[model samples]
Target: MAIESYRLNVAEVIEETADAKSIVFDVPADLQAIFAYTPGQFLTVAVPSDQTGLAARCYSLSSSPHSGRHQITVKRTVDGYASNWICDNLKPGDRLRVLPPGGIFTPKDLNVDLLLFGGGSGITPVISIARTALEKGSGKVVLFYANRDETSVIFARELTELAGEHPSRFTVVHWLESVQGLPSLEGLSLFASYFGGYTSFVCGPAPFMKAVTTALKELGVPRELRHQEKFVSLGGNPFGDVEEVLAAQATLAEADDADEPDETEQPAAPAFAGPVAIEVELDGSHYSFDDWTGDKVLLEFLESKGVDAPFSCREGNCSSCACIVLEGEVSMKHNDVLDAEDLADGIRLTCQALPLSDKIRISYNG
Candidate 1:
């Protein structure tokens, strides 16, 4: 079935933290079936920029599937155009355009041990995954969450209560910057006891996630056992905000598949030189974008053409915008999601890709 977007009415707005807020949406009875989702999926919401609040951005759903109302949390960004706007201006009774829940960051099976890691607001999805795992009797779930200070931590009380409720199944350790700063290399040794037998899921700002990724690496955790989730549009940092280390982690799959970049042949990141024609396939429908030159990325261009497609994190950090290129060449300015195997199979990030050749063929249903 084709994934669809709907305008769900805001039911309530709850302040989760000093800078963070969760907006509950009133999903109609008719839309509930489509809105139903797994543990770690996210919603891409379009809150209008002006009075109507019609602009869009992706936010991770903080409320669990067990919760009645569907809600996504937002941390007010300093100069965040979309996040700050939504925090200050959006409220209950207002309508926002929303894409149904979708994302790849979820618990795969029950037999594996689980170790979850989150930094700052990145805890949103982590909590969802952890909560669901506990309910299902998934093997021991442990979390190492990082934050700048006590107050900055999202879901702090809920996490503690959850831990108290399921002491045998779950454990949460907080790393506060004011006390000890980010988790350190020395700290990785302390968690080494659980290192060999767990699947590590890490999410947060680039630097924080990289440190977690590195700690996992030093602990001898295998690559396949690690899942990395990065927030591009962070509160202090805006979308597409990434550091060299974090960017490398996002592309690590690509790098590992190839293993080594030819020292002499390192390639510059690619981009579409100019406007080009594109063909798109969504659901079972086909559309040609002759009107859209190469002015914008593929997803934005298609949306402008009135095509209902699935996309989130316009920053290219998530697989929400991933598509398979059927023909011709396409270039991506930045990518932290798809790996080399994906590229080998023709997968590309439509949010970062621009049509390179005069014409390009792509499939969004992929």
Candidate 2:
């Protein structure tokens, strides 16, 4: 829903690899409940700017809830200026703006067969999931992690130690692309014997996910058994709400014919022109916006009107901006977070959804 940010101090910074590090937060006692999260959730960190302006990025929590500490592992992106900034500068005692844990990429049932597929830094949440599973000791935790080589793998040592500690319950497989080829359908299929009954959680770059899932489906892995998370921001919003919305002159476009979705990063929001009647209900308070449109997301529009609505990435990558449509219909530019069942339940993303009608009402307190 309307997620709020918290200022937490870095308590520890441990290097997980040559380019990746895990930052543990000193969460206040009063706010510990706010930060309590499921095994595969993530935290959105907002870094203040000196010359670059403010930058916000989401990092998955690598620590299990049983650890009673908040830790997120970040792998420095070679071309990502913000990532590079975090890797080079963020340290213990540094105060940073971080949103509470948020994400739906968690194990549905721990008692069932649990397998995780991660590539590169995507190992963060799966690591958490794996540890939590091992701690529970009721299910088997299997992880197939891929990286360039042993040198670049984050949490390489810790994961191995975990496997050793829980030899019977946990199994960790490493795919060093340097020795073997990059993760492919064939590479993934080799693990097929482990598939049919296991509930698979996959996260990585778009191609890796697509290739793996496609192969799984072809191998007869049921659709309901597989879950995926596209960790990057797919630009210009995602088609979140109504697939078919009123276009110019009120013409309807074919929902099934929408353009192929591109997977990460993005363009800026467009400004809305019309005088729109916007009513938002949050925390038992009501607010209104006079000018809003499909040009900009409801989150941006509300911010411009001084509503201080919740949001992280303006793209539909996370559930920070999720809201329930109360009175009118809206559509998102892109939607990877909410599925058909969620939409059917009236849940939608306010950061990506824009009002197609003149009057719209939404609530974030859900």
Per-residue CA lDDT of model 2 for 150-253, tens digit only, reads 89988888888999998888888898989998887886887866657888888887778777777777788776577776676322212222112323212323
Predicted model with the maximum lDDT? 2
For residues 1-366, write the lDDT of model 1, one tens digit per residue. 113468788899988888888899999999998898776778876554442223446687777787766878889778777888877877889987777787767667745778888888888888888887777656888988888998898888888998998888889988899999667766854774565778888888877776777777777777668777656541111122223335565476666768665452323345556567778887799998665455677777887788876655555566777778998877776676765646877988876777778778888665
The clash numbers for all candidates, in the given order, read 5, 10
| Candidate 2: residue 119 lDDT (0-100) | 91
Instruction: Give the TM-scores of the predictions, in the order they appear.
Output: 0.69, 0.72
**Model 1 root mean square deviation, Cα atoms:** 10.6
Cα deviation at 88, candidate 2, in Å, is 0.7
Error of 2 at 230 (Å): 2.3
Cα distance off (Å), candidate 2, residue 103: 0.9
lDDT of 2 at 292: 84
* Cand. 2 TM to true fold: 0.72
Residue 338 error, candidate 1, Å: 4.0
